[model samples]
Target: MPAPVRTAAQWAQFGRDHVSHGLGRMQDLVVVKGEGLDIYTSDGQKLLDFTAGIGVTNLGHCHPAVTAAVQNQVGSLVHMQCSIMFHAPYLQLIERLLPVMPHPSLDQFFFWNSGSEAIEAALKLARKATGRPNVVVFQGAYHGRTYGSGALTRSKPIYTQSTGPLMPGVYTTAYPYWHSLGVPPSTSEEEIVRLAKHQLDMLFRQQVATKDVAAIFIEPVQGEGGYVPCPAPFMNHLRELCDKHGVLLVIDEVQTGFFRTGSYFSVNHIKGFRPDIMIYAKGIANGFPLSGIVSNKEIMATLDVGSLGGTYAGNAVACAAGVAVQDVFASEDIGGNVNARAEQLYNALYALRDSPKTAPLVAQVRGQGLMAAIEFRMPNDPLTHEGLDKGTHIPSNIGKRVQEFCLSKGLVVLTTSCFDTIRFIPALVVSEEQMDKAMKIFTEAVQNVANEG
Candidate 1:
């Protein structure tokens, strides 16, 4: 017999009783179905989804091409242990992705089930390849939640609060945040770049030696770290540092991959920046659970034949979806859409950022392509006024308030990166009409929160 569907009250009670408390949900949304850029709730309300499942649903929810590919593959085959046999979908996906990769030498691939798994694989590869003991990452970076990735993650304390003694040999350094360094608002981008390089030098001098570091992991567009795009100068400098020290540079493109940004990958935006090993996930399969890394044969060969093989790695259904996603990206001119819509969002958001009504609470509006954010300053934040530290600093609370207001107004948004920035990562298929509607709701929500303050 088929299982019976539960009513809203029953489902709520079941979730309360059965779901693990470790999982954090943004809003009280029990979605029944999704299509395109909208999700239908159990209460029968259609919400314009701007979160895109935290940057997973790049081609939009249940894209027809992806759905058809998955359905077709599920009938023929689903699980194929990669170590035991070769599968067509997996092979096809690799063929589809290779042409669009930023670098010509990033030809080899290794598949995994999630971003965290891919990260762990890359960590092993780095250590094995370089014969080094330590790895370096940045503050405010969010890699993943596994013990290995969590050690590299610095976005939030709650992620590793009681999880004792995370993987050792992981070092953290300051990323370039011009606003947080207490630098003058008038500081030019060149000055900010110099400050960032100085901080990095200080880290190498004080904390971990560059020679001992096996790899320096970077998210070219810091996703959970406030949608802050790494300046090209910094990326070039990092490349130079890695070359000088023989440390491999690993780029984590989990959240920024598959046309979420205007490019096929965020690394393309940073001129001449390339990684020794690059991790991929989230948008690769348009919500399907699949991730992998790309590297040259020389770097990938560090992992012995038996070292990387999961039972469900490169599952046929997910790989089929990935192939379809690539096809859609090619035929649809998705990059063009992202550039146009990103401009629309940035203009509307900057207007709100500069508005006399909302300017006080707005710290910065920054993004590239469709991955964007409007950071909120705490009530007593220094940027809000020349001199103030009064009252409890609650930018996170303010972000939550704006998120809740958007939810009530029939839009689904999210808070990310230090818990103060309202992140907007809509689907690649989001239409111009939808963009106008979302911005209208978002502007009003910000105004409402400002009024409350």
Candidate 2:
């Protein structure tokens, strides 16, 4: 067969015609392969990866150990229907992860292929256990885009624009980003808890009836909703509220699990916050497509043998990668390294805020662990206060400019739902040297694009 000769733009246009309009595609870089936290485009540009494939690659791209593990499993068995039977890798992974998890009561896990599927299972289990219908989510939440999880998502009209008439009995309340959501002032910690309680209380008035509500879904450190961490008191109180109302607390750790936040799960960050059910993925398999919903012995026992499984639910190859991921994380002090890198990155980006390059458009810097964001805002002339708090399309456009500049100059970053912010989900294994290289490039990109954006 002869090679198909066509320009990249032509190929992209072809995709545009064949694919649904809902799919977002851009002709930015033609990537070939990846290594660690760097990607090589078709044209031979090696770029530092801060997005980590949008937080999917916490161990880094094509990590040697993970790749080797996958290769070995592939030679043995890549696909096996756990619904029909079980495989070594699948059982092996659960045995390994059980001890590391926060809850001692957790006894069973149902493996799924993606974060959305994991969340879907969690929701189902919550309803099955409680025999309830209503589920509570928060404003600015971004769970996966499937029907149930998507229904739980409470951000912008765009995500839910075309897909409508979603699942009912899904309630929502604000999660505090005190400065952004027009909250008058940075509330005291007590006030934050008060506000959350008040909002949930108000929701019981109409959005969702307390008795019928099955679960309250939460992210310990929010992933897509601008990396906001729910304060400890707020989380603890929510636990109390769930206990009072017979609501299952479902922690969505799709983005916060697997040492991304210096713990196996971010829910551990709170003093006593533990979920009746939890979804885990992203970093668990170290870039493999393995996600799961875990629950207490009682809740998990409700499922019939055949109720929760799929053809590729616990893929041996993906599980093999997961097993190796945990091993490397444990033996190599990857968690410690993640903490050190977070500190290093926090210091670097914080210091760079005052740098001559980033002063104009930089509004706020916030996030946890390897998940961080640099929010770009329109230069509010504090002199006039024209739009001191009013959000404009300017920040969105500036973000695009910065993203392009980063790509052009050998760096990769991700934009967020806030539109004005670019998130950095660097790999847990990112070295100090790699960190310096990426930050230097970022500083340069900011300097180059600042005047224009």
Candidate 3:
């Protein structure tokens, strides 16, 4: 018998009753289907999807190639545990990834189910390889919510609050984000970089020594931590520091990989950049639960055979989807599309930032490629005029109001970090018309919210 269809309200009630309240949601709409840059709600509304499942469906929802691949793999072989046996899809995915890796040194791969799992695996590998007890992460970094990764995360207190006895030997340092440094948006990158470097140096001296640090984890473009891009000079400085101290550099590309940043990886935008370990997920399989870490052979060889296997690490269906995603990237100029659409989106955002009606509320417009954000300044708060203290930026509801307004107008966007910031992560394949429509809705939402104050 066919399952009975439930009304949108019934479905939402069911979720509320059974689902964990801890899980945060952007909207209450019960989405039934998605295609291209739109999601169809059960209530018969089609909304423009700017979040792209929080940057998961880079090829767009139900991308034909990825869908077909998943269907085929389900019929052929769905779950061949990685430790028990090697499947054709898993091997095929590795082959597909080899040619597109951001750096030639990142030749080895280990598959996992989520971004957090990949992060955990990278941490283990870094520690085991270096035999060091300590790890370092940047302020405003969001690695993941899992126990180990949560300790590495410094985006907000909410992530690590009350979760004490957390992973030990993890230290936090400063990232070159002007907003976090309590500086004007017009602050020079050189000065920001200098401040960040000084903070990291101080951390090494005050907290953990360089020799004790196993690896320094970083997001090329911070995701939940306000979509801040690490400057190239600062990145190079990290490489130099790592080289000088023998600390491994781990780049978390969970949200910045798969050409979402107009390049294979956000780090690729930095000239001649290479990480000791590179983590990837989110867009890897076009919404399928797949993530992995890549490193050179020597680094990977340090681990024991039994140390890094997961029962569902390399699920055949997800690997098949990954292979198909690679094929699509290879055949389509998705990177070019991302670049063009990013330019359009940024231009619109800049216009909003410059508009007199909204300029007071718009603190800064930042990010790269398709991964972008607009941070708002709370006018009534004294912090708006003064420099913000570390981790103490006054919270504003402007982003939430803008988000609500956009949702009312049939648009889907996400608020990020702990401040009043809204991020735009459209699909890599998002069309020009779709982008324009999204921007129109977003512009009105911003204007309406800004005018309210």
Candidate 4:
């Protein structure tokens, strides 16, 4: 098919008419250009990007290093089947990535194209390594949408509605969300962690047998379920449980990896937790499609040759970009910046959460590093549903309203966690000035929503 030459409006209409609506469509703006965390629409409006293309561009859009790397590699070698031959960029990336692994034993890697594919690959590795038939996942986790991934995702019903019978032997367990567990806002972190840890034991006895499980998948900070950070004590307990059961502790850092969580990985916040397998994507290449998993040699050895690679698994261009990303991180204090900005963001969000007008609507303000969220709830509403019955918070699209309002103010944001929570996942390269500007707009959006309500 040839490119269509049409006006911006015409192109937009054509997309609405011809494009498959299955993909998530949050806004209608047609972006034409991007630079350093700002995107330009066809109308020549500049929007400060807070979503960072849904956490893909961690170094900001079109960082000079990444652009140069891609341009340089495209002219040399863009595609090389990993199964057929090896490449410098791929090996170089592995070399750079090895030093950053949380544990020294996590030395093995298998590249893939997307987070979903990496997750699918990890699932296969777990099952093969343990020779177990069952996999365990937490409730309200969003691993991916592929059929195999869908079986593990329990964030929302729409993801798996009419998509089952999902893959067999996949079990769901409750995660620690004190606000959603009917606990008062004053509940201490220790108590929440205790209750959450206790649920795992109940799940094992009442639900799936721990002996049959191959892996227990979880996110240090829940992404789509809301940017809820898992408490350290709870994660510590999970580590103990996995150790006792010999289940692989697979941490899905697809959204939280690459310094998004202040640390190199969110799991790093916990003192002694070590994952058996770590899967990463999103910011791995600062926008390029690259994802992979790291495991020790022994577990990785379980897969026979020709068992785990794809034709385009380690594409040269993506690996080159990945290599450049690591270089950028080495030179830039991105992890430091994320921590500093996260503190500022949390202060501002807490102000909003505590203010008179917004307090009643905000159920909680939670985050770690740059990954943050403001969860909204309408306590006065008389409506009762499954979420209410199950003691889970049901969003009322307040986050979506805030998102649209932010867009109107030349800022871009995303809604997550049941459409009730506003997630802030800006690029790690975002400056303090940019953060203040975005927060100003966000504050007004919350105020406007409160007034309208």
Candidate 5:
């Protein structure tokens, strides 16, 4: 017998009753289907999905090629435990990934279930390969939420609040976020990089010594940390520092991989840049539960044979989807689309920043490729002009207000970091027309919020 159909409100109520309260939701709308650049609500309203399932749907929801690959794989094999045997999809996915990797030196791969698990695996590999006990991370970094990755996440205290005694042997240094450092937006990138380097030096001298540090984990563009891209000079400096101290450099590409940043990987933006280990997940398989770390054969070989296998790590279906994702990347000009859409997004955001009504609230606009953000500062905030009343009182949660406004008008966006910053993570395949529409909705939302303030 068929179950009774429930209205969207009923479904939402049921979810609120049964789902864990800790799992936050941006909206109560019951999403029934997603295609291309839009999500369909249970009540039949369509919304422009600017969040892209939090950067996991880079190729867009249920891309036809990926969908076909997954369907075929599911019919053949769903879950082939990695420890039991090798699978065709797993091997094929690696074959597809090799040529597109940021560097040829990252020749080895280990599949995992999530970005957090991949991060854990990378940390273990780094510790084993280097025989070091400590790991270094930057301030405002968001690797993941699992214990090991949580220990390294410094973007917000709420992530670690009440979670006690996180994985030990983790130290933090400053990332080149001038806003977090209370510096003006005009602060030179070189100065910020210099300050960050000096802090890392201090961490080595005062906290963990270079010899004991196993790896330094970083995001090419900090995702949960206000969409701030690490300066190329700082990235090169980290590479140099890692070389000087034998510290493995782990680039967390969870949110920035798979052409999200107008390249195969965000690290590609830096000249002659290569990471000791690259952690990938998010959009690797569109929306599938797949992630992995790629390192050199030497580093991977340091771990024992039985050290890294997970029961469902390299699920055949997920691997099939991953292979298909790479196939799409090879055949399509997704990277080109990302760059074009990113330019459109930035132009719109910069226009908002320059507008008289929104200028006071627009603290900063920063990002790379389509991974963009607009941070809001209250009128009296130090980041903006103090004592400048813009006719109305600006709320502290202005980002949330803007998000709500967008959602109410059939757009879905997300907030990031500890600041009042809204992130924009549209699918890489979003068309020019779709981007214009999204920008139109987003511009109206910001303008409305600014007016309300």
Candidate 6:
């Protein structure tokens, strides 16, 4: 969103009066239009976008091919009872997605309207297939907001406040925070690996039987819970554990798929790992409402006919958009572009890490490909060691402030996890020229905010 002369406050007030108060607004910016990786505010200010509409819009806002596909599909058949009746556009997109999937065994897909719905469907499918009610997830993981997905998201208290008496038999355990947990993330890969397996073991021993656990839900690179890349060895071990336990491993790839992580999925990047079920959305349709839960034939077939369907499931326009986006990745160096932009973005963040601007608050820079996070540290107070690393207070504030600084300077970032961190999920099409421009503006904002301190 561009900054108008009247700025965010003026438009914000108008919106508070006119617009519905239900949708959550971030940073108080009013974006009116977008092109490529840049968004223009109602005030006519242009900011380099790092957050691609919360990981949507990976092909960037309104790519011409996707736009044309959507327009063409809308003209043909915009909506259909895809389950009861067949639609060519839907079938075509599904066919396109099959080969790109991690497992050909998981060729069967159930398209939904959003990530949450896809997750909910996966949960239900797993439970039905296994004849089990219990499921497991990590402490810092996020799935989505539907009842089942919400039950597994253990990151934020606010999401659960007064809401939970959520689905029963959903269990959780300490996810590996190897570096912070005295396990040297690199040198103690052995220990880290042991801890992840142990945590799941503890969950099973205390909460649910190994056989009773239907699925182990995970995000390869956790999005809302901070962009924490699940360790490779740990992930491989998890695959083994699931096999031994006869538990399905369901991965939520809503945020990391579609070249966002330099591959179709983080799972594909990690060797010896494949989920029995995987949820994908966000960039799947280039900002359109289309998501899916794809699972192995054995698991997906457990659902009786007509058990799941949606008014907009396999929506023609969205599916066409998805197919076009897939074409872009298949033809262009979109994956390489994401990886290249990721390096540029990471390098920019690191260059600022030691700068007086970001250093005082900087904790760590972590990510894979274009999905990255900047975690802020609790400012150590010598007068009171008690304040250092205090429970979720200091970091969250710093994160918010950093978001404000970025927003003020025409850069968009998102707050995530239980930390003081901002996520960077720019479009896979972000250019080197635009990145250079963004870096300079971002540095200026951080420096200005630092000087204020």
Model 4 CA deviation exceeding 4 Å by range: 1-4, 379-396
In model 3, what is the error at residue 71, expressed in angstroms?
Answer: 1.3
lDDT of 4 by residue, 1-453 (tens): 998677778777877988887766886668999999999888678889999888899999999999999999999998989999999999999999998888788898999999999999999999999999898888789999998888889889888898688889998777888644556645788887877777877878998888899999999999999888888888888888889989999999999999999988888888656899999999999889999999999999999899989878979999999999999888889999998898889988999877977665676788889999987775444322212344544345677888889999998888886547789999998888999998899999988888877
lDDT (Cα atoms) of all candidates against the true structure: 0.87, 0.78, 0.90, 0.86, 0.90, 0.80
lDDT of 5 by residue, 1-453 (tens): 999899999999999999998788877779989999899999889999999999999999989999999999989889889998899999999999999889999999999989999999999999999999999998899988899889999999887789789999999888898766667776899888888888888888899889999999999999999999999999999999999989999999999999999999999998779899999998999999999999999899999999998888988999999999999999999998999999999999999988988877777899999999998875456654433464645656788888888888888899998878999999999999999988898899888877776
Q: Rank the candidates by TM-score, best first.
A: 5, 3, 1, 4, 2, 6
* Candidate 4 overall lDDT versus native: 0.86
- Model 1, 1-453: lDDT tens per residue? 999888877777678778999887775558899999999988688999999999999989999999999999889998889999999999999999899889888999989999999999999999999999899898889898999999999888889889879999998877777654567545677877788888889889999988899999989889888998888888889999999999999999999998888999999987666789999999999999999989999998877789988999999899999999999988999999999999999999999978978776777788889999988876545554422245533344678888888989899988887637889999988899999999999999888977877
Quick one: ranking by lDDT, best first? 5, 3, 1, 4, 6, 2
Point out where model 1 deviates above 4 Å: 1-5, 184-186, 383-396
Q: In model 5, which range of ten residues has the least summed lDDT?
A: 383-392
TM-score of 3: 0.96
Q: Could you tell me how far off, in angstroms, the CA of residue 35 lies in candidate 1 after the best superposition?
A: 0.5
Q: Residue-wise lDDT of candidate 6 within 315-340, one digit each (tens)?
A: 88888888898888888988888878
lDDT for model 6 comes to: 0.80
TM-score of each candidate structure, all chains considered together: 0.96, 0.92, 0.96, 0.95, 0.97, 0.91
What is candidate 6's TM-score against the reference?
0.91
The residue pairs that clash in candidate 5, if any, are none
Error of 2 at 194 (Å): 2.7
lDDT of 3 by residue, 218-320 (tens): 9989999999999999999999999999999999999999998999889889878889999999999998999999999999999999999988997899999
Q: Which candidate is the best by TM-score?
A: 5
lDDT of 2 by residue, 287-379 (tens): 788999888888888776677877788788999999999888777887888888888887777766666555546666777778777766644
Query: What is the lDDT, from 0 to 100, of the residue 103 in candidate 3?
Result: 80
Overall local distance difference test of candidate 3: 0.90
Q: Which ten residues in a row have the lowest lDDT in candidate 3?
A: 386-395
After TM-score superposition, what is the CA distance of residue 174 in candidate 3 from its true location, in Å?
0.9
